[model samples]
Target: MSTTRHYINLTNSLFPLPGYAADGYARIKGISALVTTFGVGELSAINAIAGAYSEYVPVVHIVGTPSTLSQADGMLLHHTLGNGDFNVFSNMFRHVSCVVSMLNDPHEAATLIDNAIRECYVKSRPVYLTLPIDMVQQKVEGERLRTPIDLSFPLNEQEKENYVVDVVLKYLHVAKNPVIVVDACAIRHRVLDEVHQLAETSGSPTFVTPMGKGAVNETLPNYGGVYAGDGSRASVRDRVESSDLVLSIGSIKSDFNTAGFTYRISQLSTIDFHSTYVRVKYSEYPSVRMNGVLRKIIARMGRLNIGAGFKPNNTLPAVEPESSAQTITHAWFWPRMSQWLRPKDIVITETGTANFGIWETLFPADVTAISQVLWGSIGYATGACQGAALAAKELGINRTILFTGDGSFQLTAQELSTMIRHELKPIVFVICNDGYTIERYIHGMDAAYNDIQIWKYKDLVAVFGGVEDKTARTFQVRSKTEVEALFSDKEFSAAPFLQLVELYMPKEDAPLALKLTAEANTRNNAKA
Candidate 1:
């Protein structure tokens, strides 16, 4: 039985809907559902769904099409492009989704639904289903409803897993300095427990890529900082690159994730543990998976000799040098965020400056950070915040926070009204730079195209129907002193209601990581 929450009648666009589903999946670590009309609506949402596909988020996308009889008769549909083809939209979605099912037969509807959902869960990607209006009420099997769909991943063959583990141990045991690098797939595959056990048992210095920011417990003594090639802090870069053995867990080496493919670690010294395979040096074991292999490796940790007397460096780069200018710079703001965040909070960052800036922010324990680093849609964080907030509310989490640049927030600002309608109490901090800061760093430093029309960002809550002093509140802070006071406030920290903070920062200043990445991006684009 599905319980209907109040309908969100004021959705501005379909672009943010997939962000909601993707972030909901992130929070719950399960599949999320999205419903759209047949043609026009699904096309508008395809970009974000493709983003979910790129980042490995499992979202079940259901489309409501015309009746089966209408599609069969080739009737002209209102949402169609004045054509008789009904499968045009589904055909487009095939490139982005794991499974695209059209429920035309009542006998196979249940099996199709079950298979679609199971594949979505197992693959950690979106699946599309077209349910005609006529088939909504069709009864297939009540017996199938009694048995829940099995959502387990296939276990690796024990013999192959053992061989892979032995090969891994051979490298791990001999290396004087072995470090673990956890990436986004570790979180998507639900293997953080195995990751944590391996890190703890081996006592190795563990680092995360930019996409893997919150995968490990940052408060742990063995935790190193974010490692993104030249974008990383000098200490972290040297530590990771100088290691004798690298155990990369669920790594996704995208251009942005690795600072434009700037990783210095060699494949010969790295053993990669993936969802479906294990690569030890140059040899690949196709059937061996990470979760089981990690478990077996942990069982034999007594034979490992690495990670002894390896002091971990988790400190932020010096902040006072850049923060002393009275205005809140990216350098100061991100590191200061480390002090403001609480344990178990859900933090969503936009793809612009906030995405790279967050690399410097050290999270408290069990914090979940959501960002589209690979897909990198500009306004994705605002919509994702809504879904993450809804999931957090359902899970009884106290706080959900969003960090977005002013330019990106404008693209999906209408989602704020949805947040108000749902009465979700999330703290939103809009970096009120005058333009697209990340783009400026990448290419157009002085171009007019980079500038934006600055709005009264703090007034958005009131414009979105949030009652002042009750369901919502707003603040504008410029100086470091003002930001410090705001962060120190007990009531504000508790997040009793929806709060918006218009944080003003220098337009040209960006995080160290973004600057390094943009330089690499510039160099790459200039290459022949």
Candidate 2:
């Protein structure tokens, strides 16, 4: 009955890639409802659901199960544990999801469904719901449907919030040099307006973590740069590290986000705001939530203003020429590709080379850049591109651009078929380097284990049901000159159809940041 109601919104997939589907839904900030058959189908997507949980993307995994009678009779059906324990999958889901529900009674179905969905939005994490085959035709009362499930924000203690704000004010007022650093939680928690308000009102140099790149506007006058600890540009590192006070919002201090814990900041001068708490030096305010606290601080901006002695010099220095000769390099491609993007374009970058290389490019305002820096999952961006494109379509936006390496693309490239099926127009740029450049940089630079079987990437469009000059088109370019012409070309840039650009680069070339971090990671791995 539920499927019948939303049949128009439904699209069947070739596999149970809940990971890809969940990752895709995460990009658009939408709730995913993935239907899978019991055991075989459900387990296929369990790993993806776990990824979604780690990244705070909400997805409802609905499982169609065997008959209730089979469970009662202890019948060892296909796709079961053979011991008649059908609860194993449900038990596993409890670890990854914030909520789990099963429809056993028609009278309880409506409330369970509502409550599970409410938790999904409130927590912003995946949920698991199970439906026995026998419950498929059950009817439930609609009386409670009028009252919407309460998904309102939980309030922190007003007194505690005020106390934290005053402490933050004291630090802000005395600091000669102040800066604002944003992280992933700022994007997920929906307090970006508050982050922007604080930065604008404070007139501080603002920078984003690797995960928080597109959350805040980077074109502002006081914008410092991307702050990835030692991996940051020299000027940005100097300004941020040398600051008298650092106000970090939604900060996730992961190894990747912090460039292998390379950040050097005095905790005494740092005020950290998170989704549910705030930390000032050694003192932790447990109930002081960022959403309410940030909103309150923005409201009191006039009184909290700390004028004079705090000025940020935002200058963008150009890197040296990527190629003295006419060769396509990582440094060269990303910077040039920057100008090719338009406003409101959703850009998804895969892990490894694309993830690291994209940091060099300065994104324009209103252009969203999506990448799994913290997850560091290869092949995620392709599936995420599918999600972003569909989300853009629903939101009436154009252009879903994706940048993925050859190794990662090969992992989940089947998602392109889904995009073609749904008629989503995304311009996919597959970085065709020979092997895993990131793995090579980390351990064995010349190991055969780092290599992959190369496929004719350009021919995929035809195999995936993409018609030339109609729903899809493919391009393979090998040189700087050809890439320059394609990016500069008005028609190609528009990409009115689902387009693929197989970009061939040097087998060993990697982003400068990746090379540095790979060495650090190697040392860390050696220690472990």
Candidate 3:
């Protein structure tokens, strides 16, 4: 019994896979993979799958592209012209994947495909193999077309282990207040257990980057919340700046997420366990197998004479008063929302005005889940909310809420159909100010371009297949009283409901962080 499924995408006009029926082939059990092309919307479909099943299933991608003849001519190509030509398609996904390659020769096809699949299984990340369109039907010599790909972790030599151990141990000894920063890589790599063990052993506070929001459950004593940009907690900022040693596990310093490299933590004596090699400051440590290095470090840390020193000091900076209408509304809204939150209810916020304000407000200790994408795509929240809601359902938890801006929500409004289809209920609060409020704030633009066409919030649910006036509900609240009333009603909190609360947020009501961002944008625009 074969456990792997294969999906072939040759056009019917073109030659189909020989002796293989396309129907029911997509239904195989254990290790399934898909092969398609860049121009055929396969990348987007694959990405959706990757986002949907990031931790559990691994996907091996084989994409077909135009021949080298077309590449040399630089002809206008479909889906291959974005972001600095065809090469950037791979570069854009580099952070999300472990490996990607383009294969031109028909002779190398079998070996390349075999290796790509093996790497995908081993790394537990989506790996890619781009083949030219001309090569799909070409005659190949030597091996069979259906050769089995091995999925196994190769053993590392003793010398490689010793070298990695020495470097890690030396860094541990030199710094007094060493903190471990974990990112999405830790979760993707299934190293959460190891990370927890390492943090407890070192007695250091574990700070997670935004993409690594739930790296360690917020309930843990040593788990410090997100540390990046102006939204970072004051204590976290103080700790990062003052720490003598910073050890980053699969953490990259990207611009937008890091607030343009505002963190002044010196890289001296820093150790980075990146995907390619182990790096310590300016020096590159030789390539060592990651699993071996992680295991050895965890083992050595367990033997160290370290005591738990992480203490939760929740004191935040005193709120400075701002007289904008937006500030006033957010100030009132956040405190009330904070008070209403039960520790069990999961809150997923979109990355716009809501992200800025949510970070500023106080919530019940460890009650919220914010999906901070490093890519900073606007529509990320809608899909992420659906994913989080599904996750909550699997855990048998009810009452998931999504707070999103009107502009951001517009990007993935189609996802509401998915929400209705899956029967996953979430209370969605749309801050409908009738425009891209964040962009206006950032650009200091009081122009008409930022404004968008307004729609009746309640009518959208009916259009998207929700049960009329029963399963789905929408509310438009302009004042604090209406906001309180909507939540206080039992009918509103019931199963599989969608409530679109319209709050009349002013164009001038900007948060402090957003005000700073606006000023920065204005300065940049002036320079341009």
Best by TM-score: 1
Of candidates 3 and 1, the better by TM-score: 1
| Ten contiguous residues minimizing lDDT sum, candidate 2 | 1-10
Order of quality (TM-score) = 1, 2, 3
TM-score of each: 0.96, 0.93, 0.69
Better of 1 and 2 by lDDT: 1
The sequence of per-residue lDDT tens digits that candidate 3 reaches over residues 14-60 is 11110011110111112334455565445455443344234323555
Task: Flag regions of model 3 displaced more than 4 Å.
Answer: 1-118, 121-156, 229-231, 289-291, 302-348, 357-372, 384-401, 479-504, 510-528
Q: What is the alpha-carbon lDDT for the whole of candidate 2?
A: 0.79
For lDDT, the strongest prediction is 1
The lDDT per prediction is 0.85, 0.79, 0.61
**Residue 271 error, candidate 2, Å:** 1.3
lDDT per residue for candidate 1 within 196-299, as digits (tens), equals 99888888889999999899998888888899999998878998999989999999999899998899999999999999899988999897779999998999
lDDT of 2 by residue, 141-213 (tens): 8877666567676888888889888887777777777788998888776788898888777677788888888
The pairs that clash in candidate 2 are 19-48
- TM-score quality measure for candidate 1: 0.96
Cα-lDDT of candidate 1: 0.85
Candidate 2 lands at a TM-score of 0.93
